[model samples]
Target: MELSLSQCSKLTWTLNVHFIVLDCPGTASEQAGKSESCQGCPNQQLCASGATKAPDPAIAEIGAKLSSVKHKILVLSGKGGVGKSTFSAHLAHALASDNTKEVALLDVDICGPSIPRIMGLEGEQVRHAQKRSKPFYVDDNLAVMSIGFLLSSPDDAVIWRGPKKNGMIKQFLRDVDWGELDYLIMDTPPGTSDEHLSVVQYLSSTHVDGAVIITTPQEVSLQDVRKEIRFCQKVKLPIIGVVENMSGFVCPKCKNTSQIFPPTSGGAEKMCADLGLPLLGRVPLDPRIARSCDEGRSFLCEVPDSPAAKAYQTIVQSIQDYCSNRATEVQRAT
Candidate 1:
């Protein structure tokens, strides 16, 4: 009875829940009763049936509560400085590059958020509009939320205890205006700390789904990544697969490929093989990739023909296949 009721509720407000937003200058804590509905009301965007802009947040609220979104994936890494954020940024850009799907990137990495920089948009923060806080929309197909965008500067270090961090993330999940999303990719901070625990626990409570572990080809990194897999299994979170980053570097001058990270070096793929997980794709080290990041542009979105771009696309396609097969497998299991 409850499930049927929930589905019906989602259908009832499907049209009005999704709205586009741009951030304004203000602190989230200081802003109260502030909105930018005048900019672009969602009711106007949701339909063309002569439906005027909605005056209430109820429609969007219903969409959040009841809508069965296609997927909520976490792009995770076992260790820090592993290009996990880059992987996430590219995955999202690849997914939404077509402008056919409604995609969102949720930066749960409160300590170190790079989504804003990776996506090539800076100086935008989450803003409240139309009686709901809106994710900063970079394009028609993509919306992003991150502490990096909210913080005044990149070097601005946030110092808060565990419970507070958890509460803040929960608030993002609960209050921020995520509507009728085809996918929500959460980029998590490295380490199995309170931040990670909070995220996994919250998703478990909400049935939000699983993650993709990012790792390098080095055995040392793979060792840490293996611990991550064990951690996921402990928490009952599903492992989508493993993404091998910095597999090899190709020289642009001579078109020569170099084995910067040894093949079977870290045994990441072997670990996946032993554990029965998919090998999503391998990414190479590209100087232009780092340059693009330094320039604050998404490598894939800005330069689609770049090696980084193609690598990300392959990973995106692999994920698409995984989801398709997983869905079918689920149906059969049931």
Candidate 2:
């Protein structure tokens, strides 16, 4: 059943599977004109104020939608606290900064949905549509959605079990109103948990294109990255390579670089070489980045001159280069 809304006011409708978001003023006219019921829309009744809530999104239906989307990439790591979410947010932000492409950041880390906060969007939720949950825009080129948006407060915990976590992820892939996107960056939670497995399961079936594994230069984190790579191998999910984060720390006083974590077993370069995947790039432990994120700001604009921002730009550019070169290699082999 659909909710019959009388204007976009305080008229409450029981929560349904989906809500008629298109019932709003101008959008309603456009959608109604395209629907099968358009021919019989009498007296302009549909747009004349009395509108109803749309049905909830079918579970599989939403997943199918995501599967069809082009350039869906899952960002994963073997462990937590390696700034995976920050990398996801910045990467999406970098892509969105370009006027040519569309970008979306899906915070699959439901427990600590940091993308909303990292991208300078905190305490933001879906302004419209009470029934069907959807994503909201961070800006023109970039749009973001996270469970954090739905929570009553930022401190709230999801507290879901396996089945529930799995369902929530499936819904995230399916139901969040992600429009046409050029790149969809999925930030999975740390480690191989139910939630992480769910993201992989969803994307692999929904035609997930590839994955980017994030890790720090420390041996502790790199060990897990290798395992994560192996897991992808078992699942047949394409690996795009690894990113070394918090690779080093930069000084503000004398500008000296210091090691934060123990060097990886094979070092960053050798580890990638051994794994036979490219070492995407290494990010220094820059305080500006953490400060910016904590303050709910995008350092892309503010810290372009900082080490972290430059590294981010390099990472995105390198991804483009790697993709282009790989395309060339494929064409040559063909």
Candidate 3:
């Protein structure tokens, strides 16, 4: 019997198969049934038949469409309110600041699409001409695409299921004409869900630079981040690094620094050390950052001399360095 998603979840539960199955040879892999980890799995036979391994035609189509994009970076967070979208917006802005580089921002957080508002393109709608959709431009170099642009009202809700969400993501990847881009930053919804899997699967044929995981200093946030790391590992996606947002707060008047979230367990630095990951940089809580985001302005430009801005620049530079090194390695290999 073909099991539904719910059924598969229940079976995983019954078999005590943790969602973070570290050794799981993905169902689409050739070792699906042959691997020791698949021995007692309920869907072992079905996966072994190679039925689920059939590559989606859209994957190739997407790869072709995004061939001109030099680097594809996914901004992910295990929980919301970690400034993942903010980081994505700034990353695009920073890259486009070069003027010579073209940058694109794609928001895949369908249900809770905030990129439109965050990027100050809330009232903007995607223009369709000759059956092709064009992303909205923030400037000459920065372009953005999000489901938020499709809705008639910013107050509208996108009540969609897994299949619908997946289809929409496919359209975004395949239909949108990004032209040539130096970087394509995708801001995804929190957690390891259908959207995450869909994007990863669709971009499988493309050379994805990697993912930048965002998190706060709190242990609660770190716990979910660990699961997210495992999800990336299981999917075989490279992790660029981890960013600790709202790391601390510096009082303007007193020049005193305070641990706002309080990294109960040594925060992202300790976590990164433990996991062998890089701690990109810690962004301090700045009221101006929030104000700038709310007003649809670039915080880096708004407060160029602030420590938070410096931290962002440092982190963005680190990401650029990583992408440059990756490109060099690819070129050498080729």
* Candidate 2 to native Cα RMSD, angstroms: 16.4
Local distance difference test scores for all models: 0.72, 0.73, 0.90
For all predicted structures, in order, the TM-scores are 0.75, 0.76, 0.88
Over the stretch 187-234, how does candidate 3's per-residue lDDT look in tens digits? 999999899999999999899999999999999999999999988997
- Candidate 2 is scored at a TM of 0.76
Candidate 2 Cα misplacement greater than 4 A, ranges: 1-63, 127-132, 322-334
Q: Clashing pairs in model 1?
A: 218-266, 219-266
Q: Candidate 1 on 92-137: residue-level lDDT in tens?
A: 8778877678889988988777778877777665444443357778
Model 2, 1-334: lDDT tens per residue?
A: 4545654344433221123322322322445444433333442454444352242344357567875455777888888888888888888878888888888888888777888788777888665656345677778878888888778787799887776877878877877778787788889888776886667655644556577888887787788888888778866888776788887787889989888785847556778888789777888888888898898777787778887788888888877665556557756999
Best by TM-score: 3
Q: What's model 2's lDDT at 246?
A: 83
A best-first ranking of the candidates according to their lDDT comes to 3, 2, 1
Q: What stretches of model 3 exceed 4 Å from their correct place?
A: 1-13, 16-51, 127-132
